[model samples]
Target chain A: MNNNILEDLELFNEIIKEFLNEEKTTPASKFISPENIMKEIDLKLDKHPLDNEKYKKLLKQLINSTPKSSSKHFFNQLYGGRHSKAVLGDLLAVILNTSMATFKIAGPQVIVEKTILETISNLVGYSNESGGTFPTGGSMSNFMSVVMARDKIDLSINKRGMSKTLIAYTSDCSHYSIAKNASFAGIGRENVRYILSNNRGQIDIISLEKEIKKDIDRGLTPFYLNATAGTTVLGAFDPVKKLVNICKRYKIWLHLDGAFGGSVIFSKNLKNLVEGIENVDSFCFNAHKTLGAPLSTSVLLVKKKKYLYKSFDNDAQYLYQTHNKDY
Target chain B: MNNNILEDLELFNEIIKEFLNEEKTTPASKFISPENIMKEIDLKLDKHPLDNEKYKKLLKQLINSTPKSSSKHFFNQLYGGRHSKAVLGDLLAVILNTSMATFKIAGPQVIVEKTILETISNLVGYSNESGGTFPTGGSMSNFMSVVMARDKIDLSINKRGMSKTLIAYTSDCSHYSIAKNASFAGIGRENVRYILSNNRGQIDIISLEKEIKKDIDRGLTPFYLNATAGTTVLGAFDPVKKLVNICKRYKIWLHLDGAFGGSVIFSKNLKNLVEGIENVDSFCFNAHKTLGAPLSTSVLLVKKKKYLYKSFDNDAQYLYQTHNKDY
Candidate 1:
């Protein structure tokens, strides 16, 4: 390694040592209020680069003030602790810095991603035809599901803008991404029928069916139904098995948002929460949340792989030079 | 630090040392063909965890078989070379692992992101009211621009599905994401008017105007015009200043996709390539490209900050607990 990389690596090791010691003693770092952040630490990006010592000092100070999400005491959201293996994987990924766009560039890294997706598919009881890809995060995975559902219902929607009012059903307890994704997919936020959730925070099957029927009666296309594997607040799992029939009868695509609790599939005792996962048109989960990976590790799986290509496949001559059949 | 962490860190140092040594001797590693990838690397994910020694061995094997994206000889895409400072930043981010959703959780990290956005906005000559956010990648930044443009022209599209035939124009030489983003935004891929590029690969100004006029004559709403800075196949820059009048006349939102070459804003000489960047309604670029940050670092800036919230803001009581006005 060159002198620059060696110096940076030494700085990294020193900082990590300090961080680990702090975590052991305090667990949670001192929280700096948003208003006082500028006074607490120097966060400026100057035209001239800082010297190695100054840069290291500034980085350590900034890190000291920032929230310790990986610490045991930090529990603000759905994700917290960092698995050692996962951290190792992330460090390696940063060092590799490969773009997984094509096989030619990514090589075996593509196989690694594919294997993880396939393993998840198998866990969900999906068929050999099932396949998936890693989106940026839960919101994007939800967005992709909405777009695929729209295209499946009306293939012409991909070619021509929406002419029919496509209605989607989701419980009020579901992730907020559902409504946002609806708007993104051009279905309109108002078109998403927020079904009433039971006291337990699960989607009421009757309410979902009622909303679907009402939309159909209004001559609107009931295209998608989003069921939560684990709701945001109550950590409630929607009745996935019960909604399967409703989706089948109404011809609406069913998607399971396992952003908060989808990692339950990894557990033999808890996999029953998503009992009808195989029957759902699509499913997504954040490994970063329950699997203790780094932030933004989301995977989206489809029952039939063709829908993924149908919705997202766009050709560019320059990017895809390889003519591999598997990819 | 725990024994596990120490062991992993030691292993990481060892692997990185080997990687650097290999990079020096052979800048580009051997390229394994797609068909031979499986035979070359053992990528199976077993149910039980491998022993520490076995795990380290497997990891090294996997790393050896993978492509050396950070090496000097690896130049498959728009990005390469790992800047020591950027690598340090990414490592710190992984350790912190804080989500930038709200001020309470992210704290100074939010300010850091905001500062970068503000600096970029100022560089583009945007006013104090201008702001931006970090999306997942270039494709997503482009997608957000499309959605915002669609909502800006007709706000009702967010509430009611598209009743109007909205048209978008982009150069044929632009990134392939334009058509895909159009489909995602509900404008339909066919609705994207692919204006022919001149012999130099820049968007033909006359053809763009002609398409806009033709669409207007057909009672279609021309909502967005995407100008490219450093197109995919040929590193061509579209005439940003010339398109300003056309977009103004049509009342269309102009977005600059600088995914491949927006870093020129930092160069005194090359800044003239994107001369009228200040007039654009929205602008985006991938820091991972020319800036040499890690993969998937994209920034999207908007001239008017309110339009971001207008298009993407949705409330969830559980996630956004703090009522900070700045966030």
Candidate 2:
């Protein structure tokens, strides 16, 4: 046979193998069985993607056989443990992946979101205008508080740029996320101005007032105050009455980080812990924390739905196109 | 009968009806129907400690009637859409509730958090020094990025205050939360510059570079850039490579809000969109968004671990309890 003919036949075999492999193997994998036609990846040194067949199969099998995060009883995190009716909803969401930026795209998810938000808003004794989105956690809920406060000070932050030395206040016992939030707002951690707390870990209102006065004296702007519903450290509640009064006096935005204890709203006896909560601008709780829901179920609600729009009302196309269409 | 005695007895009857209502009912109607006098609540709203007979019945009914979210088809929000496996683990977490802030208090939760974080860090191709925490959502995640950026610019922000003239950039295609985040951090929304994007919705890098320089020339501090992946808009990805270089040149902190798109780290085909992701100073994603996990399953990670500590490292009592002594 001519050398050219032999080379052509070899090329045919290569193409056949390529077709078969491409249809079977994923880009990455790790197989446990020694003889399972896996991709030929060098586990010891080759941590990179390769074209080895045996190695690929082996990797795929390994990954497939790894403990299932959804099925295995490994609920060490703050979210899911044993899903119930909610899992059905979760799977349905996957088959119909959609965003929450609009009502039309999300369809039922939108209704569900609104209903859930309404249920929570009602629990907080908010009026019809009260509403919020499903943030990922308590920390993010707190983050929402800052956003609202910022908006109240200057709507242009969403447009032109910042103009004031905006300030935020939280108890020393507050989550570390608060100071982190302050930094994120470009407020510099120093501007967060921690207020000393009572023995029970609740905010010390006197210190808060003095500090706000000091900031005013120093010409630093003050705009928001965060009150803890149930801080992470000790399940402590701030004296909501005093804080509300101070916020009212200064016309500051009030936010409650009720991630863990917010669900206490469900128990009549426990409701008093968050007394005077209605006076605040916004509140949120982690349904996953005490309500026995899955993880990542933190709800951020405002006394008025308008505040959410005021804080986070950007309308990006594709996600919000349906929301933008005229009637 | 005496007037007081008649009132007490009448009150008792009302309380029983209150506990039996469908809205207030738990355990469930499956065990006992009201027709059979099986379902009931308290006779009074102010009853102390609740009536034992009715309370136990309610508990029993709650445990039984309690619909399982894992089993049903309910997809309202991120947290409730929990998986059964994650739920079981979460229940166990509650039976043995522990915090994950450190190894001592958290033990396994900490390990799990660390493992999950490591897996995510590896997916983003971060170096060994990369670090992060399981935050609440995209908002807090964005906020963390801002905080880290602020501190990196001038740690003095931690003590001084947000520089009112500071400039940060996010796309018009981005989430409204970014602007809110900027507002909350003390830099009023005025400081948040929403750069419009192209037809595909990617941040216009040319405009971004121009703005940074313009801000500097105008005596404004230009320090942070927020690039969205899987934008709330058309699932657009920012020009990460170009932005990373500009950030490098200008010494600005670059944050990639990959809340919806970060999950692509598990998919090779989609991963390239975030190609130059490693160049960003911080990254965040929502597992609940694409991973089919329950809500509140969100995270925030930093390429440089020091940034997390620099911005949020805090000391407190209850959470930082006196080191445990061998009992």
Candidate 3:
């Protein structure tokens, strides 16, 4: 058993060294011949175990064929690059393999996540009352914001579902996640008014207010406004300050979908991109994007901590023991 | 930089060796004095880098102090122990750090996940059209199943937001996630009729049918039925075959939350526990529980692929640039 464990570690170390060196020259796999590889690798699980030598060879082949996302040359999407500390932190997390649902299971990891959220919340100019949690991805983060907005609009929505025709406003140039999120929130995709954007792809503030006004005039409830900080296409920062006035006037739950461009809060020079960010009810940004963390490290911060409890808090007697509630 | 990387690797190697040794004897964390550890670790982010020796010292302290989930003595939770291959796969995933949302970005990883889903679906007697995805956890998996069932009952629910009074059924004895998931799907905690379980913690099929019948008479739409393959507290398997008869009679979508003991499918001796499991509309299990994989390795498989598309699929032109239609 010890020999097997050592063999696996030695194999991993060798692979790590080879991967780091090769990634410099090859970021994307040379060719993605799926059919050919499927035939060669034989991913099917048989009843009996294969020879250790064959298994090791197969592992190496699989590793070599997979795309190298850590390399600097890999720029296929918004999230790229890697940081050693972040990698180390995630590796340790996997080794520990604790569930992050409750404080009892996650332990100090809960505080670690909370501390990071608190820091990001502070950077966004949120008050001490602000709090957040990490969702699975930017889409899930955005979806959670929509859910919070929906439930906040009508607390009974959690109990009775949507009783009114709810309207959400997003720019035409914003991430497509808004539409999907609206769908998830039971606010039809059609209800998401795609206000026209200007040449720069930022939501045209005038157009946004016009749509909100029209929705209200039509006897529809204008409940949510998703302003993009960095849109997927042009990476445009919306006029957050300008939008805040309309949100306040209409009692709209303002959510900043800063999933892409929200990282500018880290740069003292570029923080102005999301100026007046604190006024928004909730804000989300993917740490995996722009910040060189691993995938699925998105944070969702809300101004009033009560909203999170109001939206997501459900009683479970078994999981939340009294000893676990440090926060 | 090379020296730093190598030193980090060596430090990791030493830690892994020590952890493996200690795990044989000690499973649970010896102690958890968070406040004291917080002071010693100095988790506050400073303006400049701390001393290398101090940083390494802090990292080692953290590794030592964390709860040992992989240890043999740690039988406090459903997911314990670790497979070396699983660890290797997860570590490589962190290094690759690719988002699983789109096929274009994830490349072969997309196929890898899909293949796993396909394999699991086949094991559950799902046809070629059956499909699934990896949610953040078993909770998320259960939530997805509810959403799919909701949407399937009234295709308009996705767009119109639960026009009908929808009701869901789950065993009295099951994972606490069901209540949270019910609230998440806008079905309300009140709407989830927890049918009483027998002495073995199996759902009372007669009681479940009685509740479904009562709800139908009262104008409530019986949309979903969640049966537990393994109850968290007792590891009880619900009478899935009996539940399926009622589900089919009422045209309700049946879901098997096998989050705890779903691996019985692999055991010829234990497979009888979940007999007639293939008839359920959807099923989910945590590989982390029985297979000794890492946490968050839950699988949710549906009888029909369309429900996955109906609930979760949305257009993201910027990210999902073709080549990922396996689902």
lDDT of each: 0.86, 0.63, 0.79
Residue lDDT tens for model 1, A1-327: 233566677788889889888888887678778778788788878988787678778888888877787777877669658787788888888888888878877788888999999988998999999989999899889989999999999888898878888998899988899888988888899998889999999999987787787778888889999999988889999999999999999898999999889889999999998898899999999989988789879999999999999999878877786538675
* Model 2 spans > 4 angstroms off: A1-99, A119-123, A157-162, A166-177, A193-222, A230-237, A323-327, B1-126, B132-143, B169-212, B225-245, B255-301, B320-327
lDDT of 1 by residue, B135-210 (tens): 8888889999999999998889998878778999999888898888888888898999999999999999999999
Query: DockQ ranking from best to worst?
Result: 1, 3, 2
Which candidate tops DockQ?
A: 1
DockQ of each: 0.70, 0.13, 0.51
TM-score, cand. 1 vs. native:
0.98
lDDT of 2 by residue, A1-327 (tens): 122222322332343234324324532122233222123322332345444465435333323332222322443333334233233233223322345555433333344466567766777788887878877667778877786777677766645544457778999888777876665555556678788988888888888999999988988778998888887767789888788889898888888888867777778899999888877898888876665454456788898777787766665443344533320
Tens-place lDDT per residue, model 2, B17-115, is 343243233322232222322224222223245554665454344323322222224333332343433332332332232344554333333434665
After the best TM-score superposition of candidate 1, give how far the Cα of residue B154 lies from its true spot, in angstroms. 1.0
lDDT of 3 at B30: 53
RMSD of 2: 15.0
Clashing pairs in 1: none
- What lDDT tens digits, residue by residue, belong to model 3 across residues B37-101? 56755676666777777777776666666677666567665865778788777877776676666
Clashes within 3 Å, all models in order: 0, 79, 0
